[model samples]
Target: MNDFVTVAVFDYPHEITVLKHLLDQAEIDYFFENETMMNIAPMYSQALGGIRLKVHPEDAETVREILKKLNDESNLKIV
Candidate 1:
């Protein structure tokens, strides 16, 4: 089994959704933490440290690279 590690944390649902779509398209396995809690209590997003995006340790570098490329292309900071 692949051990997962957090690649990024996002306070907004839309941010997570955008990254999720990109990761999905890249076919990189991933999951999110604190999504339910954040959805249930959005105000706690900051206190709870936001939603976390996790990926297999082996995919960590690739995930970072992908995010970097996307951020560069869009000229938006994601990480």
Candidate 2:
């Protein structure tokens, strides 16, 4: 995980619902930092720098492309 880098940061847990499914479908290696805490207390999202979408460095570009597609296809964009 030390080599993993943040690909994105979502402000709320709900925003990541579809994203999670998408990542799974794409078979991408990734994890959401602060996801559990955000689920417990959404207000702390900003304080914790939101829920970080961390991925292996090799997978970063792929994850970013997926994120871009998701954002392009949905009205609710992920930060």
Model 1: lDDT to the true structure: 0.84
Score residue 37 of candidate 1 by CA lDDT: 89
Which regions in candidate 1 have their CA more than 4 angstroms from the true location? 73-79
Tens-digit lDDT track for model 1 on 8-53? 8888676776777888998999888899888788999999899988
**Local lDDT at 75 for model 1:** 75
- The number of residue pairs in model 2 that clash at the backbone is 0
Error of 1 at 75 (Å): 4.6
> Ten residues in a row with the worst lDDT in model 1?
70-79
RMSD of 2: 2.5
Give Cα distance to truth, residue 19, candidate 2, Å.
0.9
Tell me the TM-score of each prediction against the true structure. 0.82, 0.88
lDDT of each: 0.84, 0.89
Q: Per-residue alpha-carbon lDDT of model 2 for 27-78, expressed as tens digits? A: 9888999999999999998999999999999889988888788878556654
